[model samples]
Target chain A: MASPPTPLRAPEHQVAGHQAAEGRLGPLVDGAGLFFKPLQGDGRGDDEVSFYTLLSSLPSSSLPSSSFFPSFHGTRLLPASDGSGPHPHLALEDLVAEFSNPAIVDIKIGSRTWYPQASEDYIRKCFEKDQRTTSASLGFRISGIQIRDGSGAWKPDRGEIRRFSPRDVRIALRRFVSSDPRSDPDRALAAAVYGGADGVLAKLGELKRWFEEQTLFHFNSVSVLVVYERDAGATLGKGKVKVKLVDFAHVVEGKGVIDHNFLGGLCSLIRFISDVLTGLDENCI
Target chain B: MASPPTPLRAPEHQVAGHQAAEGRLGPLVDGAGLFFKPLQGDGRGDDEVSFYTLLSSLPSSSLPSSSFFPSFHGTRLLPASDGSGPHPHLALEDLVAEFSNPAIVDIKIGSRTWYPQASEDYIRKCFEKDQRTTSASLGFRISGIQIRDGSGAWKPDRGEIRRFSPRDVRIALRRFVSSDPRSDPDRALAAAVYGGADGVLAKLGELKRWFEEQTLFHFNSVSVLVVYERDAGATLGKGKVKVKLVDFAHVVEGKGVIDHNFLGGLCSLIRFISDVLTGLDENCI
Candidate 1:
């Protein structure tokens, strides 16, 4: 068995999913479901595990219920195809399958990415090099990767990681509003989620409140991945969207005052997204 | 030194406060000040110590920077003037001094009086009996004992503990709205804090959000004391009011799903108070 770990493979538990004949990312569980996380070397993964467990146990009435978080299955130990020893891996619900267009964006909130730092040297380096700013810019780094196809076969994804800055979002919205929905499915879908200026701003306001009011949200840093899809064959103005918060390695007990830097940064990031949506709504119509 | 603490007395350290010549609750600090808590057993006073310490550490930017909490002075070990050795007591900022006519009302929130169980047997008994309903009735048990008199000397308050059920509030408001403020000072003061029906309700909404958003409010039960004073000489309707949250013995760590029963009970209590204030506002003019 390999000592370290190996890349994720098709799930061993068989289910009648997609049939491979269609040459598509085969029959997936309803929704654009896809779960992929880098393996943890230290114990940060443990924190994530506990967080999911806590979330699962919460009473339904605790929050305004929605499918806000990805479901957690269990961990799996896979044996290398070469017959090496079993290595540990986490099994997470794939959210990509929930969408048709399946555009995903991962936005990180807060300045200090790692609290109770992995190492003092690492924290020192983070400060010395100004990684925070660099990390913000690195939002462009992730390429939309391949997903599983029919017959549990994985294939490369063609979707690109698009940056919806204020300007970009505005342009997208304008195009969406100006073009007939019947003629432009993609723009229509984007417009639906973006909501016209006021609607989009209102939704973002609610999201901001959610973040601020969440009782368990004590992590020094969190990455919120918004997954949205546009189905060309479906209604022009309607799109599927799901948002999931990830990276719970730094969750802390009980509320204390949130750091000003983190609070301000999170606000700015959300404002940027909101601005983009607003610009789109205003310019398009 | 007394084994158990005694009632608050004139501070050993003198400041230019009320000159006790005339029998009156003399000159006090301006701004809705008042702090009066029963002494605790089993060292729960220690929790208050830490709570104040934490509040003092918080930057001014947090919590909108109102005097939302009573300020804490240091603790003192006072030796009896008769050479009776020293006893520990807390030195808190006199909230009574904050108001010109400092009328303080203490409202406790939550069905659970203790968290993490101050005593196991007590918790067991609480569970065995439905104490929630009983606690609602317990509001009437606190007598409006006499407070300070001339010279800033402490005295047993003779005021009766008044229970403002929803109906009682309605009646109070009716009386307030109908009566002439020039003739009834007390009614006028109540009317001012209630802010007329609509204003009072709006303020309650804001207060609800404040409690929900405060990350540190994990206490099993919280007591909100609203201090208001009618500036009889200023205007018929003007009043100075401030609210403070007290009692940290049951404070708990980080956010988790709050108990539904507790949340529900809190809402009910606040609604009851809000209604009472509304009645006062509506009735008073």
Candidate 2:
């Protein structure tokens, strides 16, 4: 007695230049809070599949807590939204399913996204992109952002987010936590979401700590997906803010060396958020 | 039946000018790895008793994990080490009991140790002491330190630790992790103890995150007891480094306000330790 899957209604925050073509089966969600992402069939897809399988097989103690990433349900063959032939899709926990009005941002962390094994052409492409974006200077860049306003309507900035200057990124982050992105920031909610015990910044600190010590996998071109219920009351309760590490297609073995590249980017992101929090505090006083 | 308690042979790191007389029962240890701290009859002791009782009564979910502090086993009237009269003592987990050669440092955190409720004279006394030590400038002061040398003997530096200049404090911290404190810094151990996953810095970061959000209590005049096995191999295993928040006599209720004083001190200490790690890395290179 299960119903057929439906197209995901919420905005699909995808990497720049990687959005699914119009009318094709993109992401689907069922009533059970399961999200189905159609596999790209590219090498990256296979790498992600392998990474998930390796993560699932590893002892839980050796890996970061399962909460740090979307809970993987397994790969499945599912029909597309247009009722086309079954294609492989990744089933994962719909992180924002419970939020009535969720604000989300995908920040790609790292100054260099290309791996050591990448081809010269790929390296050149990534290097050019890095230099053109905020990543070269800040070690991170906002890939996508969507915030719900007072009336519960989402205002999404997708393409422009990737080219945001450092100042633009700061403003965008401030707007992400604002009650109305079109207006002034909501100081109280900003404090609660950014500095709260379970806020975005605290969660990032936890992830940073894990990265500092974890010698298992080197995460390259990974995005930290930050989501929060914008409509939640001023006092954001426990678990209101959700931060997950996504886009692991570029992950590599640690080989007994610490992942300084990833750690550096994470620390950079942390500093940015901390600066945002400090600015909010000063403005209030 | 359990055997009688034995005098703690390890150097007792106490508050400056507060050391017990040579013949007095300062601290005791049992085979069960329980440390018995002889309570001072002063008001500070009563305050500590109340704090521990309050901590024990609070739901574990409301407080930081018990691992952040010595596990309180309740206050009890215990016989003195010299078979004298039984006196009240705080029974806590012996943090360094398992280490055959432990290096320990008690860094008292907070720029100001006196609370608003203290008498004018007491405030003046605390102010003078704060001004005289690194607490005023660094937000923390090394109250005591003991590092085990190659001969497995403790090199106790108690009184002078409290008077260490900022630079001296950094040197002392570096020495705390060095295999041979009498010689050059042990780059490998320094990296392992300061930057390693379960090392002192990571644990402090955890505590800092909790402090940033928790409104349960304002920790005043707290001491972060850092302990690690000096003899642990290059790759210090999990649980080799132990950081515990101790000395709750000056703790006050949070009253819905973040403890900025303690948080500031902790962040300062973290920066210092991070600098040490960075220096060690540069030296190795």
Taken in order, the candidates have interface RMSDs of 18.2, 12.7
Worst 10 residues of 1 chain A by lDDT: A138-147
Candidate 1 residue-wise lDDT, B129-154, digit = tens: 32323333211112121222233422
TM-scores for the candidates: 0.41, 0.50
lDDT of 2 by residue, A84-181 (tens): 77877777788778777677888888766776567779877996797789775556788877876556544455656666877777777787777677
Best-performing candidate as measured by lDDT: 2
Fnat of all models, as shown: 0.00, 0.00
The segments of candidate 2 whose C-alpha lies over 4 angstroms from its true place after superposition are: A1-17, A81-84, A152-156, A232-235, A280-285, B1-285
Model 1, TM vs. native: 0.41
lDDT of 2 by residue, B1-285 (tens): 133356444335333324445666676667457877777776877888889888888887886663787888877687765457887877878777788767788888876676666787987799679778977556688887877656654445565665688777777788777767767756557777878677888889888778766657878788998877766453467888888888888888855445656765676678678867878333312
Best by TM-score: 2
What TM-scores does chain A show, candidate by candidate in order?
0.61, 0.88
The DockQ of each candidate is 0.02, 0.02
C-alpha lDDT of residue A238 in model 1: 27
State candidate 2's TM-score: 0.50
